[model samples]
Target: MRIVPSEISSRTRSAAERSVFAALKAIPDKESVALHSVHLPAHRYKRVGEIDFVVITPELILFIEVKGGGIAFRDGKWHYGRGDGRTETRTEGPFEQASSGMHELEREFRQAVDGLRGRDAVGGYLVVTPDVDLPPMTTYEPEHYLGSTAYAGGRGLEAAIRRAANHWRGKGKNRSALPTISAQLRGDIVKAIRPEFDLVPSLHARITDLEATFERLTTEQLEKLDELEDNPRLIWTGGAGTGKTFLAAEAARRSSARGTVLFTCASHTLAAHVAGVLSADSIVVLPFDRLDEVRGRRFDHLIVDEAQDLMGFGHLEKLEELVHGGLDGGHWIFMLDRNNQVLAPAGYDPEAWKYLRDIGAMNASLRRNCRNTKQIVKQVQRYTGADLGIPMAGQGEQVVFAKVTGREDEAAQLDRHLDRLLDDGVAARDVTLVSSSGDWDNTSARLTRRFSRIDRYADTIGAGKQRNRITWASVVDFKGLENQVVCLIDLDAEDLRGRLDAVYVAWTRARAHLWIAVLPGVNHALRELGVAALAREGAAE
Candidate 1:
């Protein structure tokens, strides 16, 4: 039951003391015996220490100390500290502190009883730690200590005090006098401790100020303002590594102020991920194909993510129908990267891109790649034709280039890379493998079969889903996901004429290191794009 005095900051301690006082008032016999009292004057010689609660009956006076933390006891000492700050230094343990405090209380009780005739007196100390671990007793002790975690209910500490009170009652003490003692104890404790708890309003004010400071927009915020403002129609643009989905979700959250916000995405898996992150009571998400169904539903705002795959006049017409029909002067928000546009089935005009641009919609772009390192971003820039909007100067490391002759050489190369990264203190979650195609499922299976160390996912995995030693994904599926290091395999796909564009998307997905695996015959388009330098000597043969 011993608690760290430092762990109980003045702010929290005051609140705890108030809670104790409130709990005492609910006890049945609080008023008659003056039995409930707190912060009553100790004997003149006893040292001054603020007690959390004091309950007095005619038979007994109880002293309580409240500790709130994830309490731990190890190596014969009680440890009560928060992990958010510096590690706590253990000195005199909780047992010693509580025992000493109890000794002091006993001395004060004896002094208080000196003048009272024919009154039996008892003194006990109780320690309470709410929501913290407690150690089992190795030896018997006189002081009562209980932890909220082990106790079924929060009343563990109070129960201990009641037990001691019951013991004194058994000694022929006058039970009728309990109420007067309780009321006096409650009043005295509240008076002594009220000053400490009064600081909460000011503390809350400071926290509010901090939140306001965080909300003030910087240069990046200004660009977002312009992007959302300029594009009145369906405008879609996203930074690959940046949390585009999360930003889109948050935009939907804020858009609720203007009107009802609806979320839609091309990929069902990606849509589900976004739905999991953004689904709240207020916002709604519907499948992109379900635009017809959504047309009848009234909404104030519409947001579409992964818009690259939603090509052709039909898709655009459906969106227009939803906006014109469903919305009541609502805004439209679209999140996408145009270069990430993979093939739309035949008969679809790729010219849909030009139409959105010619419409004079707000075309805002996020320049700062907040998710990836400058080196990896630069490498991605070499493959993808994205303009480097600004120069990034930081202490982050560059992407690593590993060239192998063929797919057969990939297994050993990947194993070595994994070992080296792990040896360098890289966590498995920080690294990822990106395949060049949907065929990545087979690619990941082959790699996992050869090297059991790698972990792969078929769909896009966000920062929240990373739990394994290493995550492997296809470049297409991993579009919105990011990692500290990425190994991009099968970059030399013959079917993808603009393969460098996909490679660029894959490269930027890396925040620190990028490892690309290309076949022996490098694509000409990739060569023209300058990412062909990633191929080893004679790789294009």
Candidate 2:
């Protein structure tokens, strides 16, 4: 029930357009439609022709033009005037004007939109306000422009609109949904009608900003990263969202200045993603399993994130081989925080830590959780079955948990929280949507029109310049990245079944807040973590 490019409840700027919009509101299932005023493009001929409205019903996209005020079409021409018997002011024909405007839009659309053009799905009509009338050229138009098109008065408006919508039903990929729009389609249409943009997702802005406000760094860690640039061995530890990976990248960049740095992540997705985002000179981000490629080559230093996952994925010896042979003095940094949060069957044994310690590596831990609020950390501890007496961080809003019955309910719940955050000044870039649920297509299509699916962690900020949308990551994708807020979707007993650590990681990703949509059966477990399921305002039980 939105009027695209503007608020639906806001008053329309044009009187004639307002009348048409009011009539559209009277159509059946009007709430299922979106009324858009395709801001008219610049007219080179100095003749004003507007696309007026692009109505998106649940079935199809109906682009309608409103030629209001006192106007008429007589003979083979179009005319306009105050109609005070000052004769008539002849202008461009309404059919020709709207048709050309729509034609121009379609052309722009072909470039901006992806799955359009060949679908033969786009076509619209010309509508005159009740006060205006024309025996305009309604039928002698192009075949593509004549699909149930109409020019008529107020009462007949709904029927014409319906016919226009029904015209494109069952075409192309729009099977049962017919004219329904996906988030991508909505983005394309809005972008096409608007001015061209070079804007990236707002998240990128937040990320650039986060770099300036450095995470809570300790003096010992600072000395290790900057002061002891020659320190050949070190182990960094922190709980979830403690900025371990960020520091590792920072260390890698500084270390690279001295010589080539080899950076490694745990998962392939995480490694490729890190490779995409990390831009430090002489640093190559790779998966730990791929470390063998650099066996004979000497790297100035080595930085590894998610050491636990790496320990489980590949052997520590592979990493040892890289250090033993290459670099000046075996400079290496291993960042780890297991928190007993392993999703797979793999577990990190004391032997892993003992091996590094045996090599004279200094141990340093980040005591504070900089990525998540205190409440979020508490909730993570709760869900992980951490001892009740364990200390907690005192910041962040109480984790909000709302029970959902199924997929649809979960989606609606997520949307509400996201909208609330956006309205509350949370940048889109600072948000991460984490879910282990397999329903990515249905979930992502609904949650975001723009997002970066970070299958891996970036080693540096501002590495990849995709649209600045929020990050939609799988539980596996969110290894070292932290966000201002995280909305964990599809949480259930099944998700916490064997890998509470995955759930722990998801909850801790949020810096200021954590919103949970728990499918019914799972709440029993989450309830033990002190989560209360309340009905949102105006939400159905």
Candidate 3:
């Protein structure tokens, strides 16, 4: 038998449905087609009903009802085990349920199609209990029901269905001649039951799915949290996209139950994003610059995200004052990406590492790259030499490096890329444009003037949105954040030495797709990263 959908389309929670679906697939007759999970409206039945399986053959159409697990009939109630350590009680048995649904479906067919006035009932209902055997009940004929033992004893479900169809075929008034269902009618019946259409998700919806996968914590992250149970003063070191922010937020949330918790990060934008994630009253989330907000207040536990940035500039002294017993005797967790410190080399001091070691703070490494796809991770590792570890995410689109001649040409290329992404279904909010230099506002202004849909990034990376417009952000401000699509602008090979770290940061920000608009002279830099510029150059407008 051919299935309407070659495979089950929806994720079904019912074990019985799944079992029946598997059995239906084994039907030997190639001429028959089975529609799984047919839904019915509330017309004659006065309530919505669903037929588990609809088998259409040349002889008859069979509406099947499946009941799984431990089953019992007692005190006029049907009790069955729900496979989740729970028993569900129902008043209506499977036989009556299937019969009424079949009648309703017949009525619907008569109303939906034309010229079928008083034709004989060519189909009937069958009850299947895959996990239990039912005693011969006085209300229904034995031919209409198939229990677990029937498969081993008889020729199986297909044979039982043939027998049931023959039994129903002789019941009508014109019993002398058997009625045959034509192929055209069977196709009509399938369409009437469930119309077919392809539902392709929008670009934003697709990105949302990818984002959900990226947000899930891996076993390593969970084990790291478990390690904290033994020692709370461990420093977690990992490369970019190692889920440092997610780990920090979760650690702060868990620590809040013990006592007061302080969750601070070097980036104010990152702090705001973390604050939005953790809302417990005992947890205080803020940036290093905002330590005065909690002056004279000491927390029982401190979780520092982006800790590499806080090692110098008197930031450690401030954190020491805020955390109980300072760093030496306090309960604290520092989550840092050592490679990210290159962005702020002057602010990171080597003495801080010695201090952490001298104090015997436990250390752990998070090696999984949970954010970027395998393709993006490869490029980032190839270019930046950052050990992002294994790429947990699967294959993704290849990184694109589009060559441009000048600022005007670069802006035009960027606009065209944005249009293509949007046309391909990516939402404007899911894409971010990062400027390589400090002139982010100027870039935003220039781009906004060129494309009205472009605007400056105003809110924290992960929160808030300006619905229909794409955002432009600075390379520095968007650290510790990510987006579904990232397009790095103002890439100059002449100034590559000064801002290689910034470019690395921008490259790693993309979760699924990354596009770099390389300036005219950046072909040499592209070659170093093992990427060739696209054959077509942007036309200057």
Model 3 / residue 330 / CA error / Å: 1.3
Better of 2 and 3 by lDDT: 3
Error of 1 at 401 (Å): 2.7
Candidate 2 root-mean-square deviation in Å = 24.4
Q: Write down the lDDT of every candidate, Cα atoms only.
A: 0.54, 0.57, 0.72
Clash totals for all candidate models: 29, 10, 1
Q: Predictions ranked by TM-score, top down?
A: 3, 2, 1
Kindly indicate the candidate among 2 and 3 with the higher TM-score.
3
Model 3 per-residue lDDT at 325: 88
Better of 1 and 2 by lDDT: 2
Candidate 3, poorest ten consecutive residues by summed lDDT: 532-541
Model 1, span 437-467: residue lDDT tens? 6574467337534346565553323333434
For residues 110-191, could you state the per-residue lDDT of candidate 2 as single tens digits?
7767766565544555445555444435443332232223434355666665665555453344555434565666655645
